[model samples]
Target: MIPKYRQQFNQDFSQEKYSLLKEYLKQKSGLEPAFRVSESPIFLKKEFESKLIDASESIIDQIKTLSPDLLRKAVPDNCYVPGHTDKPHFLTIDFGICRSENGEIEPQLIELQAFPSLYAFQKVFEDTFCEVYPFLSEIRNKMPHEEFKNYMKDLILGNEDPENVILLEIYPEKQKTAIDFVLTEKLLGIKTVCLTKLKKEGKKLFYENEGKLTEIKRIYNRVIFDELDRILDLKTEFDFREDVDVKWVTHPNWFFKISKFLLPLLQHQFVPKSYFLHEFPENENLENFVLKPLFSFAGSGVNLNPTKEITDVIKDKENYILQRKVNYEPVFEDINGDFSKGEIRLLYIWRENDEPPILLENLARMTKADMVNVDFNKKDAIWIGSSNAFFAE
Candidate 1:
C-alpha cells in the first residue's frame, strides 16, 4: 500500500526484466504464475508488521486455551485424541486486514481450519521467487518452503512408513483444485485417494492399490464434513470418529473452532466491531456495515450494503453476522499504471511438533471497487483474482 515504493518500481520497470522473470519461473517451477511479479514488493513498515505478528500471537494463545474442548466437540463420536500416530497434524489460520479508523493497517481474524491448502504449489512458487528475483537474496520477506515441507513430513509420517500415509480427499478429479492435489502427491510421495476408494474392514480403513488392499495407517484428511453431507448414496464403511486406525492430519474441529462466526466474540482493538445478525440491535444506520453468512465460502452470500429489511428478513439469524465495513486501501498498481484495491490472505500452518505457527505462503486478490470481494469487481477487470509473486521489503 506504500505509494512511494510502487512509483519507484514502476519507474524502473522494463520489458526485458518481465521476460526474464517469466522465463526463469517457467524453467525452474514448470508452472507459470497467473499474477504479476513486480520489481518491488510491499514495504510493510516495521511497526505494522510487529503489530500484525502480535495480534496473531494473541489469537493463538486464546485458541490454545479452548482448542482441546473445541476439538472434542467437533468429532461426531466422542473420542480422545491418540498420542502416538503417524499422521499429519495440520492446522491453518486465516486473517483479513484493513485500514482501521486510526489510519493504521490492522488485521481481523477470519477463519481457521485443519485442512491442507495448496501446499505443494506454494513451495514451487517460493522457488520461482528465488530464481526470478535475485535481488531479494538479502531480504527476509520469504517463507521457508523447504522447512515447511520437512515439518509436514515429520508431522504426518513421523517414524512410520510414508507409503501407508495417504492425503485423503473426496473424488479429487471432481474438485476444482485438483492441480493442488497432484502437487501434494509429487512433493510428499503420498497417494491422494478418494473416500469411495477406501474399503473398510471392521474399524480399519484400507484402499486397493495395484490390485492389493493396503492398510491405511494415517489419513491426511482434506474432505469437508459439510460437503460430505450432500452425498446421497455414497457408501463407505469407515467412520471418521469411531475408527482408531486412521489419524487425522488436521482434526476436523478446528474448522468450526476458529471461524468467522467467532469474530463477534473476540475482543481486539484492531478488529472491527461485529455482531450476530440476529442479535444486532436496531440501528437506523444499517448501511454502515456488511451482512455475511457465517459458513459460506469465497465471498458467497454476503451483502456489502445491507438494508434494514434485508437484515430483518434473515430467518437463520444465528448463521449470519453483521460486520462493520472497512475501506480497502488501493494497494496494487495495475498493468495500466492505475491503483487497484486488494486484500492479502496470509497462509500459515502449525505442525504437531512445532512450538508456533509457521507462515508458509501468501495469496493476494486485487479488485477495483471499494471492497475486495469478487462480486464487486467489474466484468472486464484483468487484475482481480488470486495472485502470487516475489515480494521483498
Candidate 2:
C-alpha cells in the first residue's frame, strides 16, 4: 500500500503489461483470473505486519478454548443448535481493519464463514502476480513458507488415502466460486463431486469415478448449510451430523467456534469491540459501529454506514451483530495517483495431529472506497483485487 511503489510501477504500466499478465495466467494454469491484477504490489511495515500475525495467534488461542463447546452446540440435536447442520468442517475468518484516529492500523473482526472460500484461485492469483510483475522490487511482503496447495493436501489427506477422499460441495458447477474447486481438484489430485452425485448405502458415502463407485473415506467439505436448506427436492440417505463414516478436513465445530458472534468475547487486542444487535449495551454509541449478518459471506448484508431506521428495522435481532468499524488505511498507491484501502486475509490450516495452525496463503484486497467489498468499490478508478507477494524478513 505504499505510494512510492505505485509511482515506480505505474510509470511503466501499459496495455502490453496487461496482455502479458493474461497470457502468463493462461499458460501457467489454463485459466484467467476473475479479478484485476494491480500494476503495483502492497508493502507492509514490519511493525504492522507483526501485529497482524499477533492478532491471528490471539484469536486462534481463544478459539481453542471454546472449540469444544461451540462444536457441541453446532449439532442439530444439541440443546443450543443455531440453525441448520447439513454442512460441516470448512471455515474462514476475514478480519477488516484500517488506520485508527491515532494512526495505528488496527483490525476489526469482520466476517467469519463456516463454508469454503476462494482457496484454490487465490494461490493461482499469487503465482500470476509474481510472474507478471517480477521487476517490482517491493513485491515481497510476506512470501509463504509453504505452498497452500501442498498444505491443503497434507491437511485433508493426513494418514488417509487420497483416492478415497472427495471434496464435497452442492451443485458446484452452479456456484460462482466453482473455479476454486477446479483448481483444488488439479492440485490435490482429489475429485470434486456434488453432494447429489454421492451415493450412499448403510452409512457410507460413495461417488462414481469412470463408472466405478469409490467409497468415500474423508470429505473436504465446501457445502454451506444455508444453501442446502433452500433446495426442497434434494434427498440424501445419510445425516451430516450423525454420520460416522467420513472424517472432516476442517471439523464442523470450528465454524461456530471462531465466528464474529464470539469475537467480542475474545481477549485479543486486534479484535474490536462487538456485540449482538439485540443485546448491545445502551451505553455504547451505535454511530461508531457497522451492522453485519451473523452468517453472511463476502460482505453480504453488511451495513457500513447504517442509518438509525436500518438498525431499528433489523428482524431477527439475535441474527445480527454491530461491530465497531475500523478505518481502512488507504495504504496502496494506485496508477491514478490515489491511495487505495487494503485488507490482508492470512490463511491458516489446522491439521489433525498438528500442534498449531500453519500459515498457508495470503490474499490482499485493494479498494478505493470506504469499504472493501467488490459491490461498494466497483466504480473506483484504480481498484485492483489481487494477491500480495511476500519477501523474507
Candidate 3:
C-alpha cells in the first residue's frame, strides 16, 4: 500500500464526494449495488503488484500441468456439464494481504475461481472513482477502459452477433450482483436471460428477444450448480447437463474443477497448506485451519476456527476443504486511525490456451470484521466494502 496516496485521498475525502460517486455509478450502471461501496480506492506499490502477479502465475502454472485424472476428480458426475474448454476463459485469484512469520508484508492465496466476476462493473467503478477524485486518475490501469471493454467484447462475443450471445443466469434481475448483468448488457449488447426462460427445440436453445424467438449461439454462464440445485420449485425447459448446440465462453464444469478443490494441489509459498476434509491428517490441530465449502461463493459456509465436531457432521467430506488460516494484516489506515484488513482479487482473462491468463485489472474489499462479506461487517463500518485497487506509478 502507498501511504502518501492513501493519506492524500483521506485528506480530500468528504461526505458529498462519496455521495456523488454512488449517484454517478447508479445513473451510469442503471442499478445501485446492494453491497456497500468503499469510500476509498486501495493504492498498491509496483513491487507489491509484481509480487501478486508472480504468485498468481506460479499457482496457475501448477494447474496447467495437472494430470487429467486429477482434473476429472474435481468435477462430480452430477455437476459435470457437456462441453469442456481446454482452460477457463475468466480466472479470479484472491489474495489476502498479510504479514509473514518474520513480520514482513506478503500476499497469501485466499482462494481462486475459474468463473466470471464483476468484470463489467469493475471498469465502471474505476471510472466513477476517478471522476469523483481526479487526482487518483494517475494510478489507473495501464489499459484504457474503452480498450479493455473492446477486449472483453471480443473475448465474450467472438464472431457471433450480440443477440446470439446471452449472459445466462437464474433470475438475473433478482441477483444481488445484477449491476454487473446490467452493465454487461450495456457494454456487450447481450441480454441477460434467466435459466427458466430458455426454450429448447431439438438440440438448439432459444430465448425470446423483443417478442421474437432468437437462436442462442453462445452462453456466458453465470449459474452456480449449488444454488441451482437448491431451487426445488423451478421448472426449467433446458438443463445444463444435456448436450446443447451453444458454446460456453467458460464452461460450467471448470467452475468446480478450478475452485477450492484445487487448493490442495497447488504448491506455492503464497498458498497455505490445504487438504480435503476426508484426507485431513489426525495429528494436525483443526483450530489453526478454516473449513470451506469447495464451490460456495462469497465466503459462505466458512468456519474460521474449524473443530472436529463440525467436520465430523459434514455428509460430503470430499466437497469440503480444511485450509490453514492466514492472518490478514490490517494495512489500510482509515481517518479514524483504525486499520482495516483488505483482500485483493486479481482478475484475469485467458483467450489462448497456450498462454497464461492476462492480468487485466483488480478489485479490493476492505473489512474490519473476520471476513470481507457484508454479513461479517458491522452496520456502521466505514471505508469497508467493495473497492478497486490502483497501481501507484
Candidate 4:
C-alpha cells in the first residue's frame, strides 16, 4: 500500500461516494449480496506485484509436476467424479501480506482454490468503483477487459450451445456467490439451475425450461462437492459421480487435486510448511500451526488456535490439514486511523493441459480480527471486506 495515495484517497473519500457506490451495487445485482463489499481498494507498487506473481508461479509449477500417484492420494474416497479434466478451467491462489525478518513487507502463500472467484462481477465491481469516483476512472488491472471476457466465453461457452450450458449449484439462491451466478447468466446467457431440478434419463441430463426439457451439454459447476451429501433425502435425478453426458468446465476431480491437499506438496520459500494432521510429528510445535478442514470453503471449520484435544478428537486425519499460520501484518491504514490486516487472492485461469494458468486478476480481503474473513469481523467498517487493487508500474 502507498502512503501518498492512502492519505490522498482517505482525505478525498466521502460518505456520499460510498453511498452511491453501494446503491449501484444493489442496482446492478438484482439481489443484495449476502456479504459486504469493502469501501476502498488496495494500491500496490510494481515491486510487491512481482513478488505476488513469483509466489503464484512457484505453486502452479508444483501443480503441473505433481505425479498421478500423489494426485490420486488427494482424492476423497468415493468422491471422485467419473470425468476428470486435464486442467482446471479456473483457480485462485491466496497470499497473506507479512513482514519478513528483514522488516520488509512480503507475500506469504496462504491458500488456493481450484474454483472460480468473482470473475464476472469483479469487472462490474471495479467499473462501479471507478464510476463512483470519477478521478480514478483510468484504473487498469492485469488482464484487459475485452480479452478477459473473450477468455471466459471460450471457457464457459466452448463449442456448445450457450442455452445448453448451465451454471450448476444446489439451491444457488442461498449461496453468497449467487450474484456471480446471476452475472454468469447475464454475460453468457446461461441459466443457473438447481441440482435437484435436473432430470436424468439413462446417462443424459436435462432441465425443464418454458415447459420443455432442454438437454444440458455442459455445466459451469459452482456446487461445493461436500454439499452434495448434506442434503437430506435429496434425490437428484443424476449423481455427480456418474458418467453423465455433460462437459465439466473445470472437472470436480481437479478441485480436490489442487486444493488444500496440495499445500503440503508445495515446496517454496513463500509456501509455509504443512503436514497432514495424522502424519504431523508429535515433536513438532503444534502451537504455531493452524488446523484447517481440507475441503471447507469461505473459511469454515478452521481453528486458528488449536489445542492437543482438538487434534486428538479428529477421526479423519487425511481430511484435515495442519498448516503453519502466517501472521497477516496490519499494514493497510484504515480511515478511522486503525490499521487492518489484509489478504490478497490472485486469480488464475488455465485451459486444458496448459502447464501454468495465467494470472487474470487480484482479489483482496481486509479485516480487523484474527483472520481476514467475514465471520472474523462482524461489525468492522471500511477496509474490512472484499476489494481489488491497482498495480502501478
Clashes of each: 3, 11, 0, 0
If scored against the real structure, what TM-score would every candidate get? 0.81, 0.86, 0.98, 0.96
lDDT of 4 by residue, 106-219 (tens): 889888988888888777777787787665555466466788787888888898988888999999999898987887787788899999999998888999877989999999
Q: Decide which is better by lDDT, 2 or 3.
A: 3
Residue lDDT tens for model 2, 212-245: 9999887887776656767999977555666567
Instruction: Name the candidate, 1 or 3, with the larger TM-score value.
Output: 3
- How big is the positional error of residue 197 in model 1, measured in Å on the Cα after superposition? 1.5
Global lDDT of model 1: 0.63
| Candidate 3 lDDT, 1-393, residue by residue in tens | 688898899899998999999999999987899888998888778878888989999998898899868888889888788878888889999999899999878889999999999998988999999999998787788788788988898789989999999999999988988999999999999999999999999999999999999999989889988888789898989888999899898899889888999998888888999999999998989988999999899888898988788899999999999999999998888888888899999999988543878777788999999898766788888889999998774
Could you tell me which residue pairs clash in candidate 1? 88-156, 88-249, 90-249
In candidate 3, which residue ranges exceed 4 Å CA deviation? Answer: none
Candidate 4 deviant stretches above 4 angstroms:
378-380
TM-score: the better of candidates 1 and 4: 4
Error of 2 at 133 (Å): 1.4
Best by TM-score: 3
- Give stretches of model 1 more than 4 Å off: 2-43, 67-91, 140-144, 230-244, 283-285, 353-355, 370-376, 389-393
In angstroms, the error of model 1 at 224 is 2.0
lDDT of 4: 0.83
User: Order of candidates by lDDT, top first?
Assistant: 3, 4, 2, 1
